[model samples]
Target chain A: EDQVTQSPEALRLQEGESSSLNCSYTVSGLRGLFWYRQDPGKGPEFLFTLYSAGEEKEKERLKATLTKKESFLHITAPKPEDSATYLCAVQDSSSSNTGKLIFGQGTTLQVKP
Target chain B: DAGITQSPRHKVTETGTPVTLRCHQTENHRYMYWYRQDPGHGLRLIHYSYGVKDTDKGEVSDGYSVSRSKTEDFLLTLESATSSQTSVYFCATQPGVAKNIQYFGAGTRLSVL
Candidate 1:
């Protein structure tokens, strides 16, 4: 069974604090790993897609790195505006044709100012 | 914001009633997906459509059915609503398998009482 697990269900960080969220997966074959940001009462917003091990992608204060067994989303000097639920999902090779993604429970981060 | 829209942003219905949620995309993407988000469970795929009239079940497809009669529309129906089905449902679209990047709608919050 392909599965995804995200650690630290909830985190409270002060403004300007940096942190990293973890996403680990066990899959038959990894086709892709995705990161998303979801605000309250809203749908998730796409963040990054890592296709292979050792691949890294960055956008502003956010950086995502992927490895064979896990992926990490690092937030640098996060502000209150950056507070949101971070979601991680994995696309198994078996579900490639349909583009199905198995998602994790997500990590809710709160940046207190 | 890939031009995806989900109807009935908020709905409250009784158990055993049939409910349908509509997802419309302006880009005429070939792939559309339905997922349910819940606390502690994350987001789980309910069903997906590869193309017009082509659909497949996802990890959590029980009691859910989907249809895509045209290129830009996807519908998800719950034959009989249950209390356990209360969730925030999301709709996503992907251009193709190769792209693998999915854009999401604002989501529909459903409550079954």
Candidate 2:
């Protein structure tokens, strides 16, 4: 079965601390991987999309890198504004072509100022 | 931000009552999706519409129904709300130009008593 798992269910870091979140997947054929940032009581906001292995995307203090079996979201010197639940989702090649995605449980990060 | 709106930003209902949530997108995207977010379950797809009158089930579609009568509106209905159905629901739209990238709305929080 196709599935996504994210590590470090919750993390608390002092401001300016760096950390990495992991998203491991098991799918028949990987089509794409997506990263989203969600604030409490709000919907998810799209961050980046990785289509193939070795692909990387960056925005501000966040960088996402993808590999054959997993993806990593690296936060460099994160601030309190960067403290949000990070979500990882995967699209499989065998999906119905309507762009279905399987999501992970997400990693909750807290950056204390 | 993408032009997506979810109605009834918050709702409270009793079990066995019927409820409907609305998702409207002004972008005219061909694909619309419904997902529910919970603490440990992350985001799970409930249903999706590819076009007007074309809808399909997702991994967690049971007890739910969806309709897309026009190009801009998609509705998700719970024939009889249950306590288990209480969750934060999100709506997403995928622009045809980049089918893999999805934009989301603010989400609706539902509570079932």
Candidate 3:
């Protein structure tokens, strides 16, 4: 079975704090990895996609990096508004054509002001 | 934010009753998905559609059913609602093949009493 696990179910940080959330997976033939931010009571918003090992993509305070077995979402100098549940999903080779995604539990981040 | 919308943002019902959640997208994507979110368990896929009338089950597909009869709408129905089915249901859609970015609807908070 393809599985995705995220660490530190919840994290609290002072504003401007820098930290990284982790998503580890066990799947065969990874086609792509994705990062999304979801606010409480709302839908998730797409953030980044990393396709191969050693690949990274950045959007403001967020940077996503991927490897063979894990992916990291690095948030630098985060703000209070950045406090949201970050989700990681994988698109395996077989689901590539259909756009099916397997998602991790998500890291709930709280940036205190 | 990518033109995806879910109806009945909040619903509370009793067990054994049938419930239907709707997801509509204006992005004209070819793929649509239904998922449920729960603490510790993360987001679990319930069902997905590659195209109209082309739907498949996901990891947690039991007790739930889905239908997609048009290009822009997908519906997820719980055949017999249970307390265990109480969850925040989300609908997502993305362009197939060359595109991997998934856009999600605001979600429907369903409480099976």
TM-score against truth, every candidate: 0.98, 0.97, 0.96
Indicate which candidate wins on TM-score: 1
Summarize candidate 3's per-residue lDDT along A75-104 as a digit string, tens digits.
999999999999999988998878888899
| Fraction of native Cα-Cα interface contacts (under 8 Å, chains A and B) also present in model 1 | 0.90
lDDT of 1: 0.95
Q: What does each candidate score in C-alpha RMSD?
A: 0.8, 1.1, 1.1
Off by over 4 Å in 3: none
Better of 2 and 3 by TM-score: 2
Model 1 spans > 4 angstroms off: none
Docking class of 1: high
Which candidate model has the greater DockQ, 1 or 3?
1
- lDDT winner between candidates 1 and 2: 1
Model 3: per-residue Cα lDDT over B1-113, one tens digit each: 77998998999999999999999999899999999998878888899999999999988999999999999999999989999999999999888789879898999999999
Of the pair 1 and 3, which is ahead by lDDT? 1
* Best candidate, lDDT: 1
Two-chain DockQ for each candidate model: 0.92, 0.73, 0.88
For A1-81, candidate 1 gives per-residue lDDT tens digits of 999999899999999999999999999999999999999999999999999999999999999999999999999999999
* Fnat values, candidates in order: 0.90, 0.79, 0.93
Q: What is the TM-score of chain B alone in each candidate?
A: 0.98, 0.97, 0.98
What tens digits encode model 2's per-residue C-alpha lDDT throughout B63-110?
Answer: 999999999999999999999999999999997635668899999999
User: Which is better, 2 or 3, measured by lDDT?
Assistant: 2
Per-candidate Cα lDDT values, in order, are 0.95, 0.94, 0.92
